[model samples]
Target: MKKFIMKKKKILIVLMLALLLASGCSTNDTKNNINKLEAENRLLQEKIKNLEKELNSYKKESKEKITIYYIKSTQNDFVLIPEVITIEPEPNMLKAALEKLIQDKRNPFPKDTRVIDVTVKDFIAYPNFSREITKLSVGSRGEELAVASIANTLIKFPGVEKVQILVEGQTVETLAGHVDTSKPLGRNETLISIE
Candidate 1:
């Protein structure tokens, strides 16, 4: 009977040891998981802070506005177009218009060309061209459409009279294939069709 009691005691002790070992292992695993989650959370917070800083920088840069000067032809003489009477183009609008002009496929000029300058005087509109554009073979309708598009867009401003185009700061030979390159452009009035 004493031997039997001793064997039973040994079995109970073994079972207790096994349970304790299992619980210890589980506790270690839980601690590791918690540590991993903390690291991930910290990394995510850092990323968010960096993104916020970048956004703030962009806003600050855009707030530094750019100004352009224009000259208007008056009945008596030429005058500096008043700064109070100016147009502020949305950044994406001109880019979208250029993209549309290029994607039309029907346009004869190279799609890569850019509008260097756009000026409005006495309700007339003018757009200066890049050297790359002057090298391209543009048609009359294409030039007219380009001028009309810019003029009509600018006229939406308070005191714009018209649009004229120049290439590399100088009057170009012509726009696309039509319209005299030498003359300032008159508002087409029809370009208001662009929504």
Candidate 2:
């Protein structure tokens, strides 16, 4: 009986040691898992910070400066002059430039005229205007000034070598029956004056 009791006591001690070892391993695994989660959280926070900085920079670039041409009457003749204006950035910057010209008070274009759209292809800019562009009441000189102003303004943009004025999406021969707008027009440097 004494020997049997001693054997039972030895088995109990061995079982208790196995239980302690298992609990210790589980505690170590829990600590390792917590450390891994902390590392992953830190990486995610860094990515969020980087994305916010990029968004802020994009917001700053949202405004653009564009040059618009307007007619300025010289002592004896009319000429086109460039005026730099700030506007909201647009995917179609050529259209934005034309709209600014139409809005300028110094422009001889019809008051009711509107810029329908502008499309570019192969270094040519096509500025489509509303029908009111045909209602140019200003005479021959006014016609020249208007066409030159439009052409010079668009040509200054990159990749725009010439301008083809359109009225309601149709190619027109003239804006006021004076300027030949049947073909694409290049920049008229002669009509532009700095003074």
Question: Which candidate wins on lDDT?
Answer: 2
| Runs with alpha carbons beyond 4 Å of true place in candidate 2 | 1-61
Per-residue C-alpha lDDT of model 1 across residues 93-167, encoded as one tens digit per residue: 433343344344434556777766555456665556677776556355445655554444455445566556677
**Per-residue alpha-carbon lDDT of model 2 for 1-195, expressed as tens digits?**
999999999999999999999999999999999999999999999999999999888878888888888998878888888888888888889999998898888997778899999999999999999999999888998999899989998998999999999999999999888989999999988888885
Which residue pairs clash in candidate 2? none
Query: How well does each candidate superpose onto the true structure, as a TM-score?
Result: 0.41, 0.70
Cα RMSD (angstroms) for every candidate in the order listed: 11.9, 5.1
In candidate 1, what residue range of length 10 has the lowest lDDT sum? 79-88
Q: How many pairs of residues collide in each model?
A: 21, 0
lDDT of 1 at 57: 78
- Candidate 1 CA-lDDT value: 0.56
**Residue 105's C-alpha lDDT in candidate 1?**
47
Q: How far is candidate 1 from the true structure (C-alpha RMSD, Å)?
A: 11.9
